[model samples]
Target chain A: MRVTPAVELDDVSFGYRPGQRVLEGVTLRLGEGEFVAVAGPNGGGKTTLVRLILGLERPGDGRALLFGEPAHRFSQRRTLGYLAQRFELGGDAPATVREVVSAGRLAAGGLIGPMRRRDRELVAEAIERVGLSERADAPLRTLSGGQQQRAFIAKALAGEPSLLVLDEPTTGVDAETQESLAALLDRLHSELGVTIVYVSHEFGAVERFVQRLVLVRRTIVFDGSPQELPGIWHDPSHVHA
Target chain B: MLESEFMRLALGAGIVIGVLAPAVGFFLVQRRQSLIGDGIGHVAFAGVAAGILLDVSPVLTALVAAVLGGVVIEVLRSRGGTAGDQALALVFYTGIALGVVLISTAGALNVDLFQYLFGSILTVTRTDLVVIAALGAVGLATVGLLYRALAAVVVDEEGARVAGVPIGGLNIAVAALAAVTVALSMRVVGILLVAALMVLPVSAAGRMAWSMRSTFVLAMAIGLGSSLVGLTISYYADLPPGGTIVLAAAVVFGTAVVVSAARGR
Candidate 1:
């Protein structure tokens, strides 16, 4: 039997309102331990795709599956870690790095219970992985942009998710921070064998690490290896190119 | 300070509400929904007036009305029918208008309205104390248990939902907790001033706290201190307890702001 894909979008379509679709009949799949980068221009439904895969929003048509289970019905949410774009945490939040990371265990221990010893260990481990152990107790707002991103990454890593979904993880960071994030993603994929699906508008930074590319323009316009990117970019018929 | 039995009961009730207000208010301030307390207060006033008109217990009626009002605000927010502040304003004005009309029709404006509007802590009975204790316990316990989920939602709602946190249910639960907090605090601070009691201490604590947990604990302490000190001053000065308590909290908030600015935090 074939192994179940980490994520599968079978002819999915979505729109925020009626008759104005953002994503239309897009089918994609990410196998276990695969590193895929979704590249698209602004308003190309990259974030919507992430939302569907995470079950934050449902598909208007077709299906979204995570580990062979339907997106909405998938109960093992602890297995998926999501790093949203910058400004996602809002301004002036008072949560510390450790406290924010520990929230990842909410799915494991639930909302109404105390954190166990194991949860604490996982939180510490996650923070250490992000190299923020020294600043674990510091408030998230005090951190720089890249450090805040790492803190959120630690939060996602705390859950020990097998499938990591990141949406524009390097949007507003400097070039050096972007390179660090790429290196971290590489390590996460190679060492931890975590399946990463990240969305980005900037292709040069993450192009080397991603094995496959799913270029979207309100639909799955191109789905192939990174070598085929030039062909799509050169094609005059692709309006969004 | 606690010489009279009435004073003892008032203190007991005040202490519980003092802790409960800031506990719930931490999230309210963080979420930028501090004015929700004012909206709920107005709804509770309508409830009190309805209860008087129907010859039922006003406190109990206010509890139900406030909860319902909170749920309405949540529903409107979820439906995207109105903006968050708009929803609050809608409920707030409707409630106050309904209350005034009910009271006018009933012609019960002599003493009952005065007590509900300004509060009468010295008039708190044993039954009121018991109700306050029970409701305050449940409200505070809910906040304690759901602290992580609630905080997660406040920090990043979509992230929390992706992590399998039930955002809608938890939001409603929070609104309900706020409703109960408003209802119970009405006795100590009155309908007009309960929101101040809930928000001012948390605002002060937010300026100094390094983390969320510290913020919560600090807010509770500030609230408790303000309540006790305010009650004492009101007793000696013969002023309204509700106004005095709120003024004390405001003073603390101002002091906190100054100190934070001095420390450049």
Candidate 2:
């Protein structure tokens, strides 16, 4: 029997306002454990597309599915990990890194209870994986941008999600951090066999490891292996080329 | 006065409200809605007035009215900015106006209304003590059991929502807790000043907080200290406990500001 795709969008269309379209007639399917890079120019609906997959929005037309279930109605939330672009933890927020990361396990732990020992171990391992074990007790706002991103990655990793989605996870992060993030994603995808949907305008550090590269410009303009990307369209950020 | 029954009852009420206010108000201050307690308190005043007019228990009536008001404000806030602001203003004015009209209609206008508006702790009865304990218990338990979820929600609301945290339900639950806190505090601080106890202590403790848990604990301590101290001072000076408690909290907030600044935090 054929296994259900991790994510499938059938003729999806979405817009923030009525009678206007951000994306149109988009159809895509991502298999389990596939490492896909979604890139497009500025103003493109890259964020909107993934939001639909995450069930944060409904399609203006057609359907978006997660593991063959309707995206919005899917109840297995622990199976999906999402790292939002520019997630704001207040400047003076007193939440420690460990506290922030442990929230990722909320789906598994359920509401109103203590975090079990195994869950605590997973949270520790997630922090260790992101190379932030020492800073776990520090307030999240006290960390540098790159370190903060790593903590957020640890948060997503703690969930042990089958489908991991990150939206511009390295926008303001330095080159060193991007490289580390790419390595982390590589390990998460290859060794653990986790499906990754990475959305960004610049390919920056993730280009070589992605199994499939898809360009979004209102619709799917390109869908193929990274090796198949034409030299003229080498730069993912400049879609006009 | 220390040997008097009324003094003991009032102190008991003070202790209950002191612990309840800041414990439940931490999220309100963090969410930038420190004034919400004030608004809920105003609505509860109207609830008190309604109880007087209807000859029912003021605490129970205030609870129902304040909860309904809290739910309304939350729903308005979910509609996003500007709308919520306008709704708060409308609710604020209507609360006091309805309260004035109801109290006048009850013919106890100045004498009884003064007690609810500014508080007269000497009037607190055994029934009031029982009610305060029960309601305070509910508010404290909700905050205790739901601490992590509530903290997660305050940190990043959308992030928490995607993580499957019940955002809307928890928001209403906290509002209800605020309403309950307001009602429980009516005897100690009165309707006008109960929100002050809720907000000021959290603000004071916010400066010294190293983590969310630290913030919560410190806020509770600051609130308890301010309440007990204010109550003792008022008993000696023959002053209103509501005004004295608020003044004590303000003094605590000012001290916290100066101290944190001096330490370069």
Candidate 3:
């Protein structure tokens, strides 16, 4: 039997206000182990699409499914890793790199219970995988932007998620850091076989890493291999026929 | 220190409230909801006034009202009917107005509202002590059990939701805990000064601690220390106990700020 697609949006529609549709009739599917980049101009519903897939927001119409289950009913959240657009250490509560990564284990058993031995091992392994083992005990604020981003990725990796969703993961970092993030993600995809879906408005740095590109403009205007994108987007406001 | 029965009861209740208030307040500060305590304090006042109107135990009534107010605040927040601060301000002013109206309509001017407003540690009876102990125990237990969920929500609410942390339930749980803490604390510091106890010590702890766990321990220690020292000073100097205690906490916070700044933090 064929494995289910990691994410599926069928004729999905969503709006923040009663009549202002952000995304309308958006239908797309991503098979397991696929590396897909969703690129769009600002206010083009890229974040909204990610929110719908993460079940943070429901589609106003049609359906959103994850791993063949309806998004709202899919409770095995441990299998899905999500890095929000604005991840930051809150207020004065200083968290170390290891502590930040350990939060990924929250899905296994919420913040109240004891973590199994396996959870510890996974946290340690994720820290190492993200190349932050040396800074595991360092406070997150002490790390560079790149290192902090890696720590967050390690946090996502600690859950051992098969489907990883990142929203604007490279919004603030330097080009070098973005390149390193892209490399780390490419490795996770090719080696660990973690399916990746990332949303970004800036595509120059990330385009080489993704196998497929989904250009979202209120709706998915383009979905094809990365090579096919340049020929079609002479102007972003209007797509080529 | 434990010479008189009233002194003993006062000290006992002080210790309990000291530990419990800052423990809950740490998360409040983390989530930038420190003002929720102030809002809940006003609502608890309304509860107390209504209780007086009905000839009921004011503490019990305050507990119920504060909890309901907390839940309402969370519900309003989740519904996005208004901004968080706007919603809280609405509740805060309405609660205080309702309290004033209830007190006047019942002609409870002779009911010693000042005692509840500014606290009367010497007036704490055996029944008051029991109520404080029970509420303190429940409040602390809830915080302990929900430590991780609370931390996750405070750190990143949207991330916590995606991880299936039940954001709505945790929000209300924290709010209710704040309400209970406010009600129990009213016995020590009074409704007017309760938010100080909840916030100052935690702010001091946050200045020094490097992690969430350490912040909790340090905040509890500071809270307990302030209460004990304040109570002793009040006993010797014949000062108002609640004001002394709150002033002590403020001193600790100010000292922490200066010391941290001196250390080039």
Top candidate (DockQ): 3
Worst 10 residues of 2 chain B by lDDT: B155-164
For B17-102, candidate 1 gives per-residue lDDT tens digits of: 98999998888888878888888889999999999999999999999999999888777767664476587678889999999999
Give me the displacement of residue B22 in model 2, in angstroms: 0.6
Local accuracy of candidate 1 as per-residue lDDT tens digits, A1-241: 9989999999999999999999999998899999898978888899888889988789999999999999988888868888886535542447898888887777765787578888899899988888899999999889998898988888888888888888999887887788788778887789789999988876656667789988889999888877778754632422222
Q: State the iRMSD of every prediction, in order shown.
A: 1.9, 1.9, 1.8
Model 2 chain B TM at 0.96
**DockQ of every candidate structure:** 0.53, 0.52, 0.56
Tens digits of per-residue lDDT, candidate 3, A17-51, equal 99999999999999999999998898999999998
Q: Mind giving the per-residue lDDT tens digits that candidate 2 earns over B1-265?
A: 7799998999888888899999988989888888889999889989999999999988789889999988887888777788778988898889878988998899868777777778877788998888888878877888989887788777667666776778899999989999988877887888888888998998888888888789889999999999899999999998888899889999999999999999997
Candidate 3 lDDT, B41-144, residue by residue in tens: 89998998999999999888999999999899877767774586588779999999999999888788664898889888888999989988987998888898
lDDT values for all models: 0.85, 0.86, 0.86
DockQ-best of 1 and 2: 1
Cα error, candidate 2, residue A169 (Å) = 1.8
Query: Where is model 1 more than 4 Å wrong at Cα?
Result: A87-93, A231-241, B81-87
Q: Is the docking of candidate 1 incorrect, acceptable, medium or high quality?
A: medium
Q: What is the TM-score of chain A alone in each candidate?
A: 0.91, 0.93, 0.93
Cα lDDT of model 2 by residue, A1-241, tens digit: 9889999999999999999999999999999999999998878899999889989899999999999999988888777888888866732447889988888877777778578899899999999987899999998878998888888878888888888888998888777777778888898787779899999887757888899999999999999987888876676342222
